[model samples]
Target: MAHPKEVAGFKLGKLLIEGKTKQVFDLPEETGHCILINKDRITAGDGVKAHDMEGKAAISNQTNAKVFEILKAAGIPTAFVKIASPVAFISKKCDMVPIEWVTRRLATGSFLKRNPGVPEGYRFTPPKQETFFKDDANHDPQWSEEQIVSAKFTFNGLVIGQDEVDYMRNVTILVFEILEKAWGLRDCALIDMKIEFGVDADGKILLADVIDSDSWRLWPSGDKRLMVDKQVYRNLSTVTAADLDTVKRNFAWVKDQLDHLRPKVHHKVVIIMGSAADVEHCQKIGKAAKKFGLDVDMRVTSAHKATEETLHIMKQYEDTHGALVFIAVAGRSNGLGPVLSGNTSYPVINCPPPSSNLVQDIWSSLSLPSGLGCATVIYPDSAAVMAAQIIGVQDYIVWARIRFNQLEMAASLRVADKKVRNLSIE
Candidate 1:
């Protein structure tokens, strides 16, 4: 149901191909971009049952646009460009990957079928990742990493391998985790979701395809009775007009909630160094904090030499702001962390400048008087991470940043472990 203007924007060249859910159009003027027209039709069980609810194309377009927009903002690599119309959007032209990457938080659906004896609501700690061959004729059988690596599949002129599979899994989990935290603030649990990837002309695999209400089972407050996703449509005994309308309403509700789900950017992190000598150390923390989307302010003030000035600085920061954490940087006989911790109600972390007597410097921070709680860190980045965690307790974006950091480390370990195991072959 594309509007005349929308069709005019995409149909200038030729219709590339049409799938069950969308139509791919080739754009001769743009070498690396194409237009994707989302269809209103939806199906479950590998197209066994199908329905074409009215106005679904626009609803799905809205949802996919919001999902892709947020993913791009979160620094996730994707193939989304911009929404072209109410039912269409422009995206990077890529050879689509024939695999579906799935991530799950709860043991339900097909998971229980495969792993019997597992409880329905049993949670996955880091979320379970799975891959399946996208074969509608064969019911999309699950595939292991070994199978994916060994199978012969080429996308965007790049062949699949162990590294490719590993990267896809990593990106899939990242997308899930970031969006999961986003939804968590809306009092919804992202039970499970799947996404497809595509290799661009430059051979970089990116998150692609549509992610709307059809992508995941979103249980509000972790209750299945309040589920709002394609599952609601799947659960219907027999599709009818009323049931289709209910599904349409649920999809709209899910799309409407996305606008308010992202965490607010009001939280701020301030780093105060006692002297100019510690400015370098404070900057390191501030830089790393900014990488994780933390709004950081660096200031130099001494709690011992300029106690009044330091208090003024803290007071100025908290004059109107409430969600803020402080990191104090002072070297020997550190009084900055203690003074800030004692005076302020906000969290204060000690990231003292390095010294020859390192143990003593750390002890100065660790050994605080009763009721004074200023956390200590040896390195600058860790100090930033600690402060993020403290603020993340209440800020969802900060929490997601910390989670992405963990995933980055996990990714490194995974690659290293694979290399270590294949040392004999090398």
Candidate 2:
């Protein structure tokens, strides 16, 4: 049955489209955006055994929003913007391609069916990806690269190319790896999952589609010994009330675990400088640090004038448990960057303010008078990003965010170009 046409904050206009779980509506007044509403229904086996799972819409809406937010923060390419409410979200509309891309780390289900000789527990060392064109009658036939290319689907006025396919393929793996690592940290095994892509106004492809309980296989404790995913519910020989209850309970468990999920940060720092006059220069370095998920403090200090004071402050940070990236800001025969780099074994970056008259600030940081090894950065954000990058080597959370950032930038450019073309035509 179609929903009552009324949802929170969203006045359902003409129905734009309907999927398995969501209904899209036209938001003509809302410039550059549209809304999707989650319904309290679940389907499996191509809607063969459809059922109404109460409270499911709310749970899924929250869970999808949270996951999308994290993915966006981590700089992943996705079609999610923000959650409007438990039942809705405001997002940029894109022309979705009718393909379900599945990435697997272990042999299961269809893999078992297709490759009968392969053992059930066999693991794919590098993971595998497969695409299926969405056709209900044919049950979404498996598609090869040639098939996808031949389909010739155009989105936002741009023809899909091999580069786009390759990019998505690589990204699919990275997304899975990031999520797998994250869930592992929480003692959950992300067995496998599927993701879909949509072309935005600029012919830019994004990681689109609703990823919820229906999207993946999850087994807590790495022990597929006790699996808890939709498949478990589907494999039930008979659908008894008790069986339904167990499935509901499992779904609820997944939702609860997701509610408590938090990305882990491994390092934090405050990049104190020596003077307020150099704030602009320091900010450049700080921006760079932020990319790596590093926390930077841009403060000014003078080792010569405030040697004792500076040491005292540094000592306090040293006592704390996390690694620090300090960028000493100084100019004209600068000594700050070198001084800090020498005093502490921590990774110190020297970012001396550029002075037109002296032209020696660069040297002050670059020359590094002795055994001191503090790296130098010209811009504050660049310096910050560098620090974060170095720290991120061992931090998955930061690494994931950095990767996501790159994807978002690419998507934005693609979206922009699409809009420009559309406007020109109009």
Candidate 3:
């Protein structure tokens, strides 16, 4: 078959494959990587009916790329490499498993069909996962673990192992959690979702396929009473211009919301100092805090010599409000982290300076009294990361920064791997 005319520029060596909304083409530069692009077509009922949905490809491509980048940045494994264009993506090619993994946090459609007695709005406290084979003729039968293991498919020269199945289960839940938390911030209920995975050259399962408006059941205002998803479009018996317009509007709204979505950041940095001489350490702490968008204030006091003064400073931070992260810097049997952690509910992180006696410096932070819940880190950078994580629980801005850090780390590793692979080619 001839390659789609839409795929250009990357020397489309061969037409690798085609899916419902996308087409894969071989990349001339690399043997294992390929480019996938969205097509401007819509289909349902196993392509029994189809329509030319203008601008659908661009919307799906952009939305899917954004979601993939977000998940990848958050340290979720995925098959995405980079967004090549609005309708194109460069990805590491892998044999896709012929199954769709559906994770449900609340019952909606098919579950209502399969389990007729189950209520529609029933919530799964910890979420539920179901796998369906990708055979339209069989109507994608739900497969058990035994069935999957027995089929024994091989991809990229590696057999899918029990460990991989378990890993995908864990990773799928995390993907839902991340997106669920993201949408929750916007006051939307992520009713349920589906994701697919593919094995890379090394047999690592990565989240594959697209996750746009079509992938999840989204209920704005947390009420099933107000449902806006693809099912709304699918349920329409007649495809009138008015009905199609409504569908387009719903998709447009989803795209608009996603485009404007910014992770919220409410960060505060509290710097506790042992003495006036520790101003340098406090500056370092403040610098680190700023990287994660934290507002830092350095207060000089001794945890041991001036316990009352330190407690007073803590009270000031407690009263100021917002998400707080405390950095304790002290020398010689310091108690700032433990004292701060004990007094206030905010997280405390210890970053002690290197002293002539490293053991003493380490103990000052590590040896905490009972009931003290502060964590200790030797490096200032690590302290900032811990603080960012604590703040990320409530703040999306810090979460985004943490997510970016994860992406950069992964990108660096991939770059190193590419370098090693190129050496073999040369």
The lDDT for every candidate, in the order shown, is: 0.85, 0.75, 0.77
lDDT of 1 by residue, 1-426 (tens): 442323645544567677888888877777888888888888888888899888999999999999887887666778999998888898898888889999999999999999999999999998999999988889999999888888868876778887778778888998898889889888899999999999999988888888998889999999999998998888887999999998999999988999987777578899898888877888899999987778888898888899999999999988767688999888888899999999999999998888888877677788899999888888989988888888777776677667767766776887798789888852
Point out the worst 10-residue segment of candidate 1 by lDDT. Answer: 3-12
User: Could you tell me every candidate's TM-score relative to the true structure?
Assistant: 0.86, 0.84, 0.76
Give the winner by TM-score: 1 or 2.
Answer: 1
Candidate 1 lands at a TM-score of 0.86
Instruction: Tell me the tens digit of each residue's lDDT in model 3 across 1-426.
Output: 346644545667677788777888878776778888888767777676666677777877777877786676565767888777778888888788877888999887889999898998899989888888889787788998667777888887866655456666766776787788778877889988989988888876778878887788989998866667777766777787777667667777777777555565545788787877878867876787677676778888888888998898888887876788888987778777788888888888888866687676688678778888888877777877888888887876567667656655665675576568668543
Residue ranges of candidate 2 with Cα displaced over 4 Å: 121-126, 264-267, 274-277, 291-293, 320-323, 330-335, 342-345, 354-373, 376-382, 393-395, 405-426
For all candidates, the clash counts are 0, 35, 2
Question: Worst lDDT window (10 residues) for model 3?
Answer: 1-10
| Model 1: residue 83 alpha-carbon error in angstroms | 1.7
